[model samples]
Target chain A: MKKTMTRFIPFFIMASFLVTGCNQNIKSTTTAAKPSVSTEAKKDQGPVYKGKVVGKSNKAKQISIEVGKDKDAKTVMVSFDDKTKGLEYAAAGEGAIIAYEMRDGVPFATVIKPKLATLPPGVTVITPTEVKTLIDSNKDFLLVDSRPGNRYSASHLPGAVSIPVCEMQELLQNLPKEKDKLLIFYCGGPT
Target chain B: MSTKSAGQAVKAGYKNIRVMLAGEPAWVKAGYPTYANYGWVCRGNIVLIDLRSAEKDAAARIPRSVSMPFADFADNYDEIPIKAPVVLYSDKDEETTAAMKILHDNGYKKVSLVEGNFLGWKRVGGSLEKGPVVTDVRWKRILAEGEVSVAEFERALADPKVATILDVRTKAEVASGKFPSSQHIPLDELCKDMDQFVCKIRDLQKDEKIYIHCTTGARAEMAYKELKKRDFNAFYLVAEVDCKGNDCSIEE
Candidate 1:
């Protein structure tokens, strides 16, 4: 009886080895057949820009993307094909990033994503030089002073007029009629 | 009012409504022209609340504006008149919104948030005043309450009745580590997701008390106030809780 049991044990061990080897081969073959699943997962995890479509010039299907909080970021105009879907458009606001691809000189916006935009670190405030250039270049712009009338009386920009943001709508008539004119506005800090 | 984010100057039957990014601060920093005060030239009684640092006040400020620092805002409240048209001015909209909330809560009838905050004021070459004005007295009433200590909060967490723990910190902050069993609802997006949070709270049972915490006590306090205003029983954890074998630092 002992001899018979020993022979059966060896047979059982060989059968188990064959089954395990067969399972391993099957698993390796299945893995080798499909490789795109892992690659597709990696592709989905790509960089995404969150911005808004600030401006759309008629002549050029160019849309401006302003990134970051406070709209402190400069406007970046990217041209999109006229065939682009209007459904792809997004509203302009804080934390909006319009993602587009630049091919040659034209840009094609593929997606518009909104994020909790943040100001870029180390960006200096708008300088006097910039203001001068804006005023000189944009003659038809409206210049609004957000300060109170008393403060406006003390001093103000040459062509600027006081229209406190609180009462801006009421004083709309005081604003320039031309759309192309650059509007320059200012306010006083803590004092 | 149209539903639009701040600084969105869209042309809604108007030509070239440009919203300045930094408003007045950018204008002042640019060394542009400014006036003295809301002049006698304008009609209607307008009250200005100035939110600037003590140092900035020495340079220039809006005349007739009551000085109110953004940090120590709650310290001055009584200065705000309840019946006047209140206009809040700050370097940024963050402070303006804070001030507007305070004023609105105190029974101020007409409150308008300056579009660009204070920076918008200067962009149009407005006005300025140079002097230290008396701060508002209403801030004292805005003192935060219901802050639980860290140890006390941990003890409270042990109670199974505390069904939901909310972390109001930004996503970036939560990526580091968060208290066990706490879900994230950033402060900025809290209003947007308030319905989802309420639904979750209801699923857990309306009687279940919700605990909230942020990097620091400030955001948690804000969350607690906002939730309570919406009739939710919310508590703010004032101190940091232990997470991942390390103490969570409360951002100030």
Candidate 2:
């Protein structure tokens, strides 16, 4: 028994060395390739926006705002806050300047300075038609139906997925990780 | 297998994205084909629960339905009489489906999910109840302990004994509100950040208390459960309030 154990000891050591060496090689390969994966993730960042209203709608409480139009020409629909309900209003074809910030391609008008067209850094003005056209051209973008599934199922933009904004975070993990993907969101107007 | 919009694709972290300005209206105007409503059966006695917030309840709902938002569903589950046919519908089926599963696992034997959800009901010309059907006693007992008004919560904040206030809203919501001096830890990310909570309470006695809140209280309740599971003694402060903003008004 002792002789047999001695004979197998060298084989065991050799096998262990081989397994450890292969694992090290795999680890090194993964380590060397990790930076590219992260960089790719970073490259997927969407268009960011800044700036404000460049147009308006005739309908009460409806206004057309332009932000970051020079670089991306993003346009958004805006309405007055409760405190500013009776302030001077613009008719259709009228434009107003506003300040805004957007991240991961989602835009929100943060500050509104009416009557003064102060273009912030990295901002541009674009027509609604241009915004629509830009959206149509992007094939890899993600179109989200912010309405309920019933509305989504009844009728939705071509290739859009139903994910009501109310449930955005619950479904976030299921969303793709690529940054270049455009996420377009819409509701029944403001609701 | 449904169509995707450019904006949705982008928000989903996809590289390419877009938005149809007209949204569903545009889809209809473009002459895109629509689908027929599918039928869904209630799992049991068919108590259809609308999980939309009170604000949305006024817009529309399924016939013979009760209203409860996803946030309030768990606490309110006991309010739903057990052993009845329980069906859940929401603006989005995904959320309702999730809520239904929660009910099912919690031992509600006769639960069924409404097919096509509320939208389908509307498409079929189903009648809608304006305003929420007031929650019955069963619901009140099972789901809500009532809300702590904002003013009351503010008063609590002033109390020296209220050592901590945890906000379980999503990071996005936290960033949007940036509520003064509150620690923001999304409910989903709570487990990962447990140490932060632990560290905050490390010096406190075992019976020491902490306060928690969310946009309403649903998430706060869920977070409260998780905290208890982790052996932390915490209490949830229900706001019992509706959203206040430029958006259209919705009556509960």
Best candidate according to lDDT: 1
Candidate that would win on DockQ:
2
What lDDT score goes with residue A116 in model 2? 18
Per-candidate interface DockQ score: 0.07, 0.08
Per-residue error (Å), model 1, residue B243: 4.7
- Predicted candidate 1 versus true structure: per-residue lDDT over A154-177, tens digit per residue: 444445666654564555556555
Error of 1 at A63 (Å): 20
For candidate 1, write residues B1-252 as lDDT tens digits.
000111222232332333232444334434443232334213335556678886786577766666777787776755665645556677876776666666656665445544445676678666777865656533222223665555546665566454477877766667768765566777655644567776644355555677788754556765676677667777887654434423454422
For A30-142, candidate 2 gives per-residue lDDT tens digits of: 33212122122233233322233333322223344444445675445444444433223222222333333443433333443322121111111222243356556864555
TM-score for candidate 2, please give it. Answer: 0.24
| TM-score against truth, every candidate | 0.30, 0.24
Give lDDT tens digits, candidate 2, residues B65-166. Answer: 677888878888887766454666788866776786677667664454444667767787766667646566332222234334455456656664654666
